[model samples]
Target: MARILIVDDAKFMRLTLSNILQKGEHHVVGEAENGTQAVEMFEAEQPDLVTMDITMPELNGLDAMKKILSNNPKAKIVMCSAMGQQKMVVEAIEAGAKDFIVKPFDESRVLEAINRVLG
Candidate 1:
């Protein structure tokens, strides 16, 4: 099972993602409420994958992705975007995010993205 990190500003979103990942048989290594915490937890937890919300406070997903990637270029990051954030999603991919999942999370898509990234 891959160690996964869930990063989102909403507690409910984090919990929902955690439940899904757990059901998928992946371990939820850490949960971060914002981008800063995401970066810090990434360092501490060293999770195999990260599901990062695009619009978080302090630091956005793209910036945090950059930070993590800078430290570890092989970091597998998946951007979680809400609708109408296509531009940001594209930017994230360009900025080193391995893949992305749109909001109103779907279990299948989430797992698919993670599998694709990890593979």
Candidate 2:
């Protein structure tokens, strides 16, 4: 099973994603509440996958994505965004995100995306 690091400002969101990943049999290696912590944990843990939220404090997902990619070019990152941020989603893809999940997440879709990227 892939090791995943979940990054989000909201506790509920992080818990939700963690539960999904756990149920899918993927290891939830770490959790980060903001982009800064996400980067730090990533460097230390080097998880197989990362679920990163776009709008967050201390640093944004885009910048965090860039930093992670800079640290590890092959990093597998999936952007988590709310609706109406289509532009940011595109930028995320350009910045090396493997995939994205829109807010009000769907379990099936999230799993599909993760599987597709991990495989």
Q: Whole-model Cα lDDT per candidate? A: 0.94, 0.95
Q: Pick the candidate with the highest lDDT.
A: 2
Question: What TM-score would each prediction reach against the true structure?
Answer: 0.98, 0.98
Instruction: For candidate 1, write residues 26-98 as lDDT tens digits.
Output: 9999999889999999999999999999999999988999999999899999999999999999999999999
Candidate 2 lDDT over residue span 1-102, tens digit each: 999999999999999998888888999999999999999999999999999999999999999989999989999999999999999999999889999998
For residue 27, model 1's alpha carbon misses the true position, in angstroms, by: 0.2
Highest-scoring model, TM-score: 2
Q: Give the C-alpha miss distance for residue 97 in model 1, angstroms.
A: 0.4
Candidate 2 global TM-score? 0.98
- Per model, state how many residue pairs clash: 0, 0
